[model samples]
Target: MMLFGHGDGGGGPSPAMIESLRIMQKNVPGLPDVVADTPERFFKHAASRYSGLPRWVGELYFELHRGTYTSQAMVKKGNRKAELSLRKADLLIGVFAQFRILHQNAA
Candidate 1:
């Protein structure tokens, strides 16, 4: 799986890169099949061919962005606080909705 494009900066495969792939498609001797395909299709084909591929059952920590785990402390804190706030808001909304329904029924 040769990912040919601008890494991280995101300018995706240039016309020249695409043209090069098109030119080299099935032309290179001793090389495996060289066909441009979506990641989904590639994975599907791989799964079908290699059924014994190891399955990952846990969180996939990005090895490339390991620094984020230590550097984004404030971001993680803010996200947790936001989540808690949303949960509290949901609880209050549900309580008020129930109360309103009871009051309406009583009236």
Candidate 2:
């Protein structure tokens, strides 16, 4: 499928681009039918036509910006560390509250 747009860098298709596509769709001889369609519809049609297509059951990772991998990994690690720290703090707080309740009951 020919994707005609700015794509991941994202400015979208310009009027000139759309016009060109329209012209090609109408005037191009012996060309395969060119229709601008949503990716979802395209995939759905593909899935319906092709049996035994392997279904992906995980995160759809876009590897477009491979350059940012290290930085993104660092960010993910930081987030995980912070999440663990927060969980520990929550557990400690819960324990302390229980201890305080026990002490008050014993007094």
Candidate 3:
């Protein structure tokens, strides 16, 4: 039996990659079954889901690389960095809002 990717030399997805995508499509949480047939649809569903989340939650993924999820150490580091950035953004927003309130009261 010929595999889909063997000897194609076109840099297309390997068998393992296809298998992983199949697994992800079948199991990814919050992904609609209707959109699970292909990688592009799966990604579109994922992006739409992420976009609907709170700003800070989505901000946590602004610079995210999916590869981070492949390793425990990388996941930890990525989570920490995302948390730090979210905290910083929250603090800055609070400070700016306070400033605006103070300025309005003074005026």
Better of 1 and 2 by lDDT: 1
lDDT per residue (tens digit) for residues 1-107 in model 1: 88999865688999999998987795688877688889999989999999999978887767788676588899999999999999998888789888774444544
Cα lDDT, all candidates: 0.84, 0.82, 0.64
Model 3 alpha-carbon miss at residue 17, Å = 46
Residue-level lDDT of model 3, residues 10-102, one tens digit each, is: 777777967766776675788554222556675567678787754333355545555544658976988899999999988887898887744
Models ranked on lDDT: 1, 2, 3
Q: What's every prediction's RMSD, in angstroms?
A: 21.1, 22.3, 16.6
lDDT of 2 by residue, 56-105 (tens): 98778767856774668888899999999999988887898887744445
TM-score: model 1 vs. ground truth? 0.50
Global local distance difference test of model 3: 0.64
**Cα lDDT for residue 79, candidate 2:** 91
Off by over 4 Å in 1: 57-107
- Candidate 1 minimal-lDDT segment of 10 residues: 98-107
State each candidate's clash count. 0, 0, 0
Give me the runs in candidate 2 sitting further than 4 Å from their true place. 62-65, 68-107
Regions more than 4 Å wrong, model 3: 1-71, 101-107
